[model samples]
Target: LDFSIDELAGNVATGADTLSIALCKVSAPTKEPWLTLSYDEWICVLKGRVLVHHAEGTLEAKAGETIFVSKGERFRPEFPDAGTEYLPVCLPAFRPDRCIREDESDATVGQQVNDMHAKLQVAEVLYHMCSKEDWEKSKADNAAYFPPMFDKDGFTHATSVPSLLLTVANNFYQS
Candidate 1:
């Protein structure tokens, strides 16, 4: 899959219960760190390079190299130059709610840090159903645009918990 450096947007390439593959792009330097609370991630560089700063130390990854960030490890990724593109394969998929931005207030971070363990223990797995054809299309195009209906409705649909996953998949997708 190919992408223009100007596209800073990211999208899920494909996913399953335990992991998800994502195509990520950064057009400009990031101003803050990003904390992934729910899953570990490995960023494989496809073009250009990025400096990954983690609790232990900082490392630079060039094209063809990769970096791993453990779950709960706060890290910041800085794109040294333009045309930075990478693939982040995340364990347990990626959810917006589980991703904490660095701009969050101190109080919020403190509370989340305090409740981290408890939250992790009871975290439920949510699922989103999609067609195999659509997944293949995304893989081929190197872009995963929102489902067509989402443009009309302005929202993506998802199953809230594991229990509903099978029923929803069976009802909507034949293959």
Candidate 2:
């Protein structure tokens, strides 16, 4: 590959799954295949230039310039100038699996994105470590569960990711 991408802020890089920032460096000429992205992309150029070909026309951006491409738009990115450096910011983060190529059915990706949105609407389970006695009390009262330290801390801690449950519990609730 003539290009290299380094993620600055993202799920794997900084755990910010809602957004992504990546530094892309193109050292040689290359024109990627047409594809429709599942997430919006905003690019800012630092060196050289970039040309994005889409159905409407071609969008060009030179050094010190920027370009915006909406998601679900069929487009191809070309780096005609060597040593091109740019930063791409994406909403909802950019994932390789969400990049649907022109050869691939657009409907399939649409449905997948839709299903993902639906799943998100289903609700996420928040993990809160507490004593079995406290848990039973909450279930019996059918109200919010408050820890004994609630009066001291005036706050309740919770995590949406299940993996962090143990780490948080060990660090804060270690007996």
Candidate 3:
């Protein structure tokens, strides 16, 4: 599909009860920091490059690269070098109410978390990889947990050992 620099363009390609896929086209450089409370997002970059900055650190992905941002992980994605086209596959479908912007002011952190859990239940432990900087910062702050982006949403995204972690990385995250 065609894209325009004046707008952020995207469309849901397909969706099911548990998942959905969307094609996103960004024609200009931009940065958006966001957290998804109810679902996980796996992005496959088709063209250009994007730098994703998370609580832990930053990862740069270019064409044919993929990035998985677990639920509750707060991250700011910057399309820096050029416009980008990507596909975002979200588990459990993506909803506006569950996607919280970093600067959103209406809900308190506690309320957000409560509301999120009220809607869904999590039964498994997930793992997330962070940058050394974020780890060090947490230590200096004497905080045991570096809250995920969707902490406000009440749940965080994680990958079990047997999940598609390595396969996904190998398939999409390779330089």
TM-score winner between candidates 2 and 3: 2
Candidate 3 root-mean-square deviation in Å:
16.0
Which residue pairs collide, candidate 3? 18-92, 66-172, 71-157, 72-149, 72-150, 73-149, 74-149
Cα lDDT computed for each candidate against the true fold: 0.63, 0.76, 0.60
| Full-model lDDT, candidate 3 | 0.60
Off by over 4 Å in 1: 1-17, 104-175
lDDT value for model 1 = 0.63
Per-residue lDDT over 104-130 for candidate 1, one digit per residue giving the tens place of the 0 to 100 score? 443333343234323333336556777
The full ranking of all candidates by lDDT, starting with the best, is 2, 1, 3
Q: What is the Å distance of residue 165 in model 3 from its true position? A: 33
Worst 10 residues of 2 by lDDT: 114-123
lDDT of 2: 0.76
Model 3: which ten-residue window has the lowest total lDDT? 6-15
Best by lDDT: 2
Q: Can you write out model 3's per-residue Cα lDDT over 27-142, one digit (the tens) per residue? A: 65655546545678888888988788887899998899999988887787676754688777777665455577664453343253344335443326545555588778888999
